[model samples]
Target chain A: MNKNLYIKELKRNRKNFFVWLSIVFGFTLLVLSIFPYMSGMGEGLTALMEQIPPEIGKAMGMDEQTWSSALGFYSTYYGVYIVVLISIYTASTGAGIISKEERDRTSEFLLTRPVSRKTVFWTKIAALFSLTLIFFGLQTVLAGIGLSLVNEGTMDWGIFTRMHASGFILICFFTAIGVLISMFFTPKKNFMGMVVGLTFGTYFLNAIAKSTEATKWIGYISPFNYMEITIDPHHAFNYWGAIVLILVAIILLIVALKSYEKRDMAG
Target chain B: MLAIETINLSKLYGENRGIRNVNLKVERGEVFGFIGPNGAGKSTTIRTLLGLIHPSGGRATILGHDIVSEGVELRKKIGYLPSEVHYYDEMNSRELLEYSIGFYDNINPDEIEHLADFFELDLAKNIADLSFGNKKKCAIIQAVLHRPELLILDEPTSGLDPLMQNRFFDLLEEKHKEGTTIFFSSHILSEIQRMCDRAAVIRDGEISAIENIQDLLKKQMKKVRIVFNPDAINRNLPIGSQNEKWHDQKVNFEYVGPIESLIQWMNESKVVDVVMEEPDLETIFMNYYKR
Candidate 1:
């Protein structure tokens, strides 16, 4: 990878990087703030949550018992929010990292430099992964602080860390998919649309799978289901799921680099 | 080694032919012009040499490096100015230039400063705010700041005013004197005539002729119009008369033969009026295409 291109991309995307970081941090803080009040309501809150349809609750990866535990409460609501936001952030930024040159009409300037197309492609991926790593670190810190402030009893740090780690892997997968999508399409809006469609379409499939045993196999196709607390209640690392996600990411990235190298760029 | 060489280079856009059997050679340190009308494959050939598009057949090289297999290394010693220049709009000119220079490790800062000063460009302005001519100037500076061994410019003077165009040509002459090989492509024939030592004319995806500037000028034809008395209309006229037009008592045509022969033919007829004028490049260019 070329260090110059990586550094230049980091500097070029500084503002967008910070904005994603803020969204991650702010979302974590907002969700963790309500933990104390929910814990105080106790059995009354459990009864009310149970009154809702069991199918819908299952679809959201939540149950009456989840309200009593801090980690479960975090997973049931805040987890989905974090995953969706991260999906949006990583997918859009990753796609923009390469496709922006085409849209902004700077592909000629950048591609004609004394660097190979492979170097440029890898440098951009490195910069994008670095941004995601930063976002994860900041969000983890914010979540830890929020949990400490709202602590009314013992909490599980191990499960929290494991869940966030799994999310990071999923973010990498999303980023790979995003960068691949950018290679096939030239218009920015169309690529962004595909990102959203793929993100939410898989999510709803996972949700529908949760509501019925007959459709449970559909959840296997959605990356979000890999870390859903309702599916893996113990939060143990799903080695098979992780392997599949990683392999797909690697394959997508290889295809993306090859396609970018051969494309006839029109300026 | 030659500065640039292409053998039977062909590129086809699906069924539409881009360029066919295009063979060209430019010696080191020579200024070669590529002239063609719009949609006549001038840009296609240049883009292929730059490795922006893949060719359907044949091969090419610049400075002894194959354009396809060794493009990255080949680009290290070459600079290109596209016909239409665009850059990161958010970057100021200074930042853009700095980022551009970052691709090469040892570019002298002094050269960048010299080019900026020569072009009279304001480096602090955002690229989005610069006018088209100003953007063209910025393109010129970036292309030459590295002092590359070869420069490929495609229609490099589209938006510049007459004065800037002249200064740009002078700057190019200075670079030529310093032994930098230049491949200049333009639709404007006069610019090619003014700046290039030799020129190749392309039409409908083929090179029709490649000639020295002096030889090309010598062969250029003149527009001749003669008005004769109605009774003196000669049925037999001299050969090499073309694009003829006849009115009631006036006749117009292009003359490509010896001037002495034309004068003798005019003396034989009762000539009322005669006018001889140099034809523009388009007329001459169209004539070549017709042949």
Candidate 2:
């Protein structure tokens, strides 16, 4: 990877990184910080939970445990908001990282430099995932801190670890899809709408599948179905699913690199 | 080794457009011009050499490096100035220039300041805020920053005023003295006439002619009008003069011969006044295009 290009990519993205990071950070804290109040309501919240349909509760990834424990409460929001939001940020960034150069018509300046297209491709990828890992890591760390701060009872570290592990895999899977999608589309296209649709669309697919027995097969098409965010002690981390999703991500990235190498630098 | 050599280089976009079967050999330290109208495939050929677009067929080498397989190494010695400058709008001129030079080694950072000052460009202004001419100045600075061996310029003076154009040509002269091989592409005949040693004329994606500038000028037809003394009106018109017309003692015709012969012929006649005009390149191009 070219260090000069990698550093420039990182510096160029610094401001956008902060904006997304703050949003994810604030959302993580907000979910965790509000848990104590919900748990304190006790039977009143339980009564409120009973009034909602189980299918609706399942669709939202909520349950009785959502009002009982910090991890359970946070897991509901983690899957829907934190993971999807972070994925949207990362996936949109991945989509734009290389395509933006062409869209801005700076590829001529860049490709004319003493750097191979391969070096530029991988260097941008390296910078991209570096941002991805950092963003994922910081959010995980914040969640851990928030969980510890609010929980009056002992937190289940194993379930927390399992849930976040699946979240990381899902985030990577979506980010890779973002990169691949950008390769097929015109450089001038704004990827935000597509990225939002992808992240939310798949998340809903999994939610819909879980809520109804009839549509469970539909979830198989989505990556979210493979790596699910669950606070249940009975459900273990899907190691095979994680591996498959990681491999798919690698394949997507390689496909993106190949297409980029062959693409004409359009002004 | 030749500075650039292309063997049957072709890039066809669908059935129409793009260069075809272009073969050229540019010697080291030669100032070669590539003249064609817009959409005449000049930029297409240059982009092929730079490896911006994959060649449809054939191959080329620059500084003895294969354009396809060894583009990175070859580009190290190439300085390209595009017709339309597009830089990162977020960066000021100084930052953009610095970023550009960071890709190459053995660069003098002081050269950036020197070139910027020479072009009278303010380095602190963001690229988005700069005028088209200012951005062009920035483009020129970056192209020559590393003292590259080959300079490829495409319509390089479009946005610059005449004064900057002169300064730019002066700088190019300095670079040429240092043995830089320049591939200047433009539709402007005057610029090519001023700077080129030899030029290749491309039309409809094919090379119609490649001639030494002096030879082209010599072979071109010049419109001549001569007013003779009434007593000298009986003298014979010079050979090689065509389409002659007369109005009393004044005669007008097109001449396509050595200037010395035309002058000698004029010496034989007691002439009162003479007017000669060389047709512009567009007319010359039309002559080639017609055939």
Candidate 3:
């Protein structure tokens, strides 16, 4: 990877990174900080939880434990809001990372420089995942701090780790899909709508699949199905699923790099 | 080794667009001009050589490196100025130039400041706010700051005023003196006439003719109009004159031979007034196109 290009890519996306980071930061803290208050209402919240439609609760990965523990409460939001928000930021960024140069017509200037297309491609990808990992790690750390501060009772760190691990894998899977999608579309296209649609659309697919026994087969098509974020002590982390998703991400990135190498930069 | 060489290089966009079977050899330190009108495949050929676009067939080399397989190394020695400049709008001229410099090795960053000052470009101004001419100036500096061995310039002076154009040409002349091989592409005839040693004429995606600039000028046809005295109406016209037309006491024709011979013929005739017109390059190209 070209260091200079990698650095420039990072610097270019700095503002967008900070914006998304703050949103994730706020959401993580809001979910965790509110957990203590919800748990204090204890039986009252449990009564409220029972009143919620079981289908709705299942769709959102929420349960009785959602009002009982900090990690359980955070896990509900983690599976739906937090992971999807981070994925949207990362996936949209991945879509635009390379295509933006073509859209802006600066590829001519860049490709003519003393750098191979391969170098440029991998450098940008390196920068992209670096941002992804940082974003994912920071949110995890923030949630960790919030969870510890709010939970007066002993918390299950293993479930917390498992939930975040699955969240990271899902985010990466979506981000790779974003990069692959950009390769097929015209550079001038705004990828935000498509990226958002793919992330939310797949999340809803998993949610609907989980809520109904009839549609459970549909969950197989979504990466979220393989990488579950529900904080259940009975279900272990999906190590095999994580490996498959990572391999798929790698394949998507390689396909994108191949297409980028051969593309004729239109002036 | 040649500075630039292409063997049957072709890039067909679809059925009839882009360049085709373009073969050229530009010698080291030679100022070779590529003359063509817009959409005449000049930019297509250059872009293919620079590896911005993959060639449909055939191959090329610049500075002894294969354009396809060795583009990165070859580009290290090449300086290209595109006709339409598009830079990162977020960067100021200094930052853009600095980022550009980072792509190569051993480039003195101070050269960016020097070139910016020389071209009267304000380094602090955002690229989005700069005028076309100012952007062109920035591009010019970016192209030459590294003192590259081969300069591929496409319509290099289009946006610059005459003064900046002159300054640009002067800078090019200086680079030429330092043994830089210039591949200049322009439709403007005067600029080619001033700088080119030899020129290749491309039209409709193919090369029609490649001739020495001196030979081309020597063979050029001039439009001539002569107003003769009434007494001289029946006199014979010059030897190299063609399509002579008589209108009362005045005659109009095209002269295609040596200027001295035409002058001598006129001196012997009873002429009251004479007008001579040098046809522009487009008209000369039209002659070739018609053939």
DockQ of 2: 0.83
The most accurate candidate by TM-score is 2
RMSD after Cα superposition, model 2 = 1.6
Residue-level lDDT for B71 in candidate 2: 95
Residues A137-159 of candidate 1 have per-residue lDDT tens digits of: 77778877777777667767877
DockQ of 3: 0.84
**Candidate 1 — which pairs collide?**
none
DockQ of 1: 0.59
Ranking by TM-score: 2, 3, 1
Candidate order by DockQ, highest to lowest? 3, 2, 1
Candidate 2 residue A66 Cα shift, in angstroms, is 0.7
Off by over 4 Å in 3: B222-234, B243-252, B258-282, B289-291
TM-score of 3: 0.95
lDDT of each: 0.83, 0.91, 0.91
Candidate 2 lDDT, B127-203, residue by residue in tens: 99999999999999999998899999999999999999999999999999999999999999889888889989888
- After TM-score superposition, the amount by which residue B56's alpha carbon in candidate 3 deviates from its true location, in angstroms, is 0.9
Which 10 consecutive positions of candidate 1 chain A have the poorest summed lDDT?
Answer: A226-235
**Please, what are the lDDT tens digits per residue for candidate 2 over residues A50-149?**
9999989988988988888888899989899999999999999999999999999999999999999989988988898999999999999989988898
Q: What docking grade applies to model 3?
A: high
